[model samples]
Target chain A: MAITLTRTRRKKIHAIFVYLFLIVSSAATVLPLLWMISTSLKSGDIIFQIPPKWIPNDFHWENYYRAVTDIPFFLYLKNTVLITFFRVFAEVFMSAFVAYGFARFHFPGKNIWFLILLSTIMLPGEVTMIPVFLMFSELGWINTFKPLIVPAFFGGQAVFVFLLRQYFLTIPRELEEAALMDGASRFQIFYKIFLPLSKPALITIGIFSFQGSWNDLLGPLMYLNDSNKFTLQLGLAMFNGMTKVEWGPLMAASILVLLPTLIIFFAMQKYFVEGISVTGIKG
Target chain B: MKKLKKYEGFLFISPWILGFFIFTVFPISFAFYIGFTDWNSFTEPKFIGFDNYIHLFKDDNFLNSLKVTVVYAIFAIPLGIISSLTIAVIVNMKVKGIYFFRTALYLPAVVSGVSIALLWRWILDPDYGLINLILSYIGISGPNWLGDPSWVLPSYVMMAIWGAGGGMLTYLAGLQEISRSLYESAEIDGANGWVKFRHITLPMLTPVIFYNLVMGIIGAFRKFNDAYIIGGAGNQGQFYMVYLYENAFTYYKMGYATAMAWVLFLIILLLTLLVFKTSPLWVFYSGEVEGTKNKPNR
Candidate 1:
């Protein structure tokens, strides 16, 4: 009885230690973000105050206003949204379309084609980045959204196809066969059945691709030269360059830049986590 | 009609097939040709075979960038995997408010790249930064993180550790997939928590660990945005991709950059192949013959 009592007490102690560690680590994870928000709200003088304030005495909310006004914030936002929309749309719908092909169809060299697709997922973009840049420059598409947006239409991303293909495979063939017997075309069945059934998977990739395009710095940095065409990420980089010392407004701008993805992630938190787990574990 | 039906799958996948040639195959082949020449995107291409590849071995910038990247990878990959796996283990405990902990821990990773770089720049500020301020409370001055040469890699490593929770969910999924029956069987055999973890949990989680290892390697090599934004003094933080970008755009050494890209690809491939070759030895897949157990069976 005494041994069992000590064992339960030891387990209790262990639980306490685990919770304590979790609390501390979670705070460490979130502290910088909270500090960013805190720094954003502080007036210029207090930002450098020793023993930084978690909550400032006076909330200078104009830092957000200044952050927007100092750069073309809304313009960058619009550009980012446009790029993200086109890319995500193409990636989501088109990847589903192509995945359906690989999922449901029998064709010559299907396994070979699937293997090629898988290899593309593993192939780094750096190898092709230069020549592709050259190709775009040759076509006079530099400083244009075409380079960022157009290639997404081709097959979305190979990873997206892989993800959607996996999802599509899990879908039963009975529905498709039933639709075929009822005289539905493959395209019709795909549009009407597979796409609807895979809403969670579609939304998952939608969020993933949206985050990819929206937060992409190198693509916009490489392709879009004109300020008007600058995405939010590039604009943030440019903002850092123009005003290296403006911490308050810079933090404010940083918050503004990350807000969309943050919101999307939290709103669709389930799909986000599911998408990551699926790719990480299953890949 | 029969013939058309036979090619229907091709019709569905034609976009990717076309894109594979245009965006992937053609450019890679073009990059191969370009890697041999001295073209600046403007002048007529002067064919200087293998010159850029030869020059890469001798270039100081290339060599430094390679060192920085490799050193950073060495520290970051192991530190990141351990931190994330530890967090996963901790969070896997059946406890209250675990959901909140998971979400809060993952929030930082959702913040985009440039913003993260910018945030860390301030957070790691030598004077009046949060880290330094916290250090000052204990009567120790924090090192200038992204400023000093020696601290640059450590600074990035710290950032990598902070964001380690980004992989926690995957590890959590792996942890959850572990059957309770294994623990029950181990408990019947009088195994303690640590022993059970060692004998069962860790082995079962090896596949997930293997996956993260490959990804962590790729991520370390391809690290760019943060390194670009938060450059260290004395070019200490000149990562491989940053140098590649500078070579291609800043110096207009397109051919040389492509050579660098090819080298990067090869290095990643070789490392990945090495890991894959060794995976069967360590990565425990459940359910196998007892006699063949722990043997490096293909």
Candidate 2:
């Protein structure tokens, strides 16, 4: 009885240490973000105060207002949304279509083609970046949204295809077999059976593509030279490059830009986590 | 019609096939050809057989950037793996509110790229930056982080560690996949936490570690956005990708930049291949272990 009691006490003590460790580490993890929020609300004078204040005496909401006006925030937001929408639509539909082909069929050279597709994942984009930019320039697509949106319609990312294909393979063949027996076309089977049935997989890939298209910087930076065509990432980079950096408004702008991704992540936290694990394990 | 039926799969994947040729094959071939020439965007192509590649070996900027990137990768990859694995183990504990901690830790990774770079610029500010402010309270003066050449690599490493929680979900998944039966058997044999962790958890987590290692190598080499935004003193922060970008855009040395990109690709390939070759020694697959059990003890 005495030994069991001592063991239980030890376990309780261990639990306390574990909780304390988690609390302290998580606080550390979130410190910089919290500081950004606090700094965003502080007036210009207090932003760089000697002993930096965690909570300012006066909250300056004008910083967010300035962040919008100073950088053409709404225009950039629209541009970003436009590109993201097209890319998301393309990636969600096209990637799954390609994945379904790989999952369902066994044509000659299919394995070779699939291997090439898989190999492209390891091929760094930088190798193709310069030439592709020149190719777009030759086609008079530079400084437009075409370069950003067009490629996504083709196959999207190979990673997205691979994920969807893995998901598609797990779906039972019996359903497709039954549909075929009823004289349904392959296209009809794909549309009626596979598409609706793979909602979770589709949703996961959709979220991934949405995040990728939204957060992309290099794509916009390389393709779009016009201020009007600037995505939010390019706009933010331009804002940061200004001669005199306004710490307060900049932080506010940063917060606003990051808000969408944060909301998506928190709201769809399960899919995000699951998607990552899937990629990590399988890739 | 009968022959066409065998090729029906091509219809579904035709988009990828078209993209593969136009986007992948064509650009890569063009890039390779361009690397053998001196073609500024405005000028006619002048063939320069391997001059750019040869010059890169002796180029101070190329050498410095390569050295800086290699050094950063050396420290950051190991540190990142350790921190992330540690966070995963902690978060994997069957404690209440652990999900909240997981979410909080992962929050930064989701808010990556430009915002992260801008935020870190303030956090590492020498004067009134968060690090200095905190340091002053403890009577320990912090060095000029981004401004000091010596401190620049460490600053980037710090940022890498800060985002280490980005990889935590993978390790968590790996941890969860580990069979409870293995731990139960270890417990029955009177093993302590450290012993169980050393014998079971570490081996089981190797595949996850291996995956992260490959990714970490690629990420460290391809780092550009933050390096471009928050530059270090004396060009110490001019990572390989940043230099490649500058060469292409700022200098308009398209051919030379293409050569650099090729070189970067080769380096990554070699490193990744090296890891794969060495993986068999350390990475333990459960199926392979079962096969080995049938053989006599070495």
Candidate 3:
């Protein structure tokens, strides 16, 4: 009886330990974000108070208003939206077209081209940064969104193409064969058949592309010389001066910048989780 | 019919073909050409073969940046892998509110890089930071995390760990793919939890582990925005890529920067190949034979 009691006690301890681990790790993961929101709401004096208050006595709604007007936040938002929309649209369409080719068709140099496409995934972007910058400069495209938006149209993302290809491959060949037999051309087959089946993959790629372009800083920083052309990420980056940083405004702007992504993520959490799983399965 | 389909395939794929030629292939070739020539914004290009490469060998800042990058990668990757795997394993168990826990853990990942970096900078503030305040309660003083050079990389590492939720999610999926039968068999043999994990879970998770490792290495090398945001102008936390950027853009040492870029490329390529070669030995896939299939098209 004592042994059984001890065994039950041990199991309870194990369960408690697991719960404690989960709770602590979850807190550690979430604390910084909570702190950001907390600090953003606090007054300047309260921000620097020792034993750093987790909640503000009075929430400063003015900080958000000030952050927007202080910088060209609207312009940054406009640029980010435009860039993200067009870039993601282009990447999805182009990646689907390219991935279909690899998945369905047998063409000359197919293997070689496929290899080249995949090899780019392994090549660090830093390696091509200088030349790409120089190329854009020579074309007089610097300081414009052209450099940012143009490459995206041309099947620029290897990972997206790869993901789409894997998704396309999983689609039973019988569907395509049937479409072909029904006097459907390859384009029609792609559009009417494979395209419809690949919605999840398309959404996944769209979300990834949107998130990537919206959050990208280095590309804008490298190409755009004009402060007016700044994206949201670059605009937020400008808040950091040498010694002193405006923590309140920075956090405020950060909150503004982070909100859209978070909203999208939470709204589509299931799709995002499924998308990541699909990509990982292929990997 | 096959021949016609092949032509159609080429036509469909022409955008990528054109892109490869125009963007990737052309830019890479251009990068190679520029690496041998000295040209700032004002001056015309002057061919000076191997001079940029020669200078790179002697540059102390480049070497130090490399060291910093290596250190950052080492810490970030292992810590990311361990924490993510641990979280994944814990969450994999049939527990209540698993989805909520997963979403909470992944919330940081959806946070913007700039926002997170800014948040962490505040959190790591020596005087007023929450981290320091927490440390003080334990009678241990926290050093200047982002301010001090020694602590900056680790601070970044801590921030990276906070966002390990995506990696954790991937690992969770991998863990789910692992066969339950293996665990049951191990249990029947009187194996403890640790032994089952060591023998069964670890081996089965190797493929995902390999996947994450490759992704982590690539990510570590390309890490830029966080350092740029945190370090500001003077390159305090100037990582390797950040230094490369400064040289290329800030100083207009385009040739030297291109050389640095090439070296980084080669290092990444070598590392990727090394991982690929070594992966077959350890990465366990249940359905397919090891390495008989072609490389993944990605």
Best by DockQ: 1
| CA error at residue A262 for candidate 3, angstroms | 0.6
- Residues A1-283 of candidate 2 have per-residue lDDT tens digits of 9999999999999899889988977887899999999999999899877888999999999999999999999999999999999999999899988998999998999999999998998999999999999999999999999999999889877888887888788789999999999999888988899888877667677776787888888888888888988988889999999999989999999999989988886787666556555443331
Query: Model 1: residues >4 Å from true position, as ranges?
Result: A273-283, B287-298
Chain A TM-score values, per prediction: 0.96, 0.93, 0.94
Clashing pairs in 2: none
Q: State the DockQ of every prediction.
A: 0.71, 0.70, 0.69
lDDT comparing candidate 2 with the true structure: 0.88
Ranking by lDDT: 1, 2, 3
What docking grade does candidate 1 earn?
A: medium
Q: Alpha-carbon error at B157 in model 2, in Å?
A: 0.4
At residue B176, give the lDDT of candidate 1.
78
The CAPRI category of model 3 is medium
Q: Residue A143, candidate 3: how far off, in angstroms?
A: 1.3
Candidate 3 structure quality by residue, lDDT tens digits, A1-283: 9989998998888888888988998888887778888877877777888777788888987888878998899999998898888888899899998899889888789899888888777677776777777888889999999999999888758878877888888899998888778898888988888878877678777777778888998999998879889898888888765356767777888899989988887777677667666665332
Candidate 3 stretches with Cα past 4 Å from truth are A1-7, A242-244, A279-283, B1-4, B232-236, B287-298
The alpha-carbon lDDT assigned to residue B204 of candidate 3 equals 70
Residue B156 error, candidate 2, Å: 0.4
Every model's Cα RMSD, please? 2.4, 2.9, 2.7
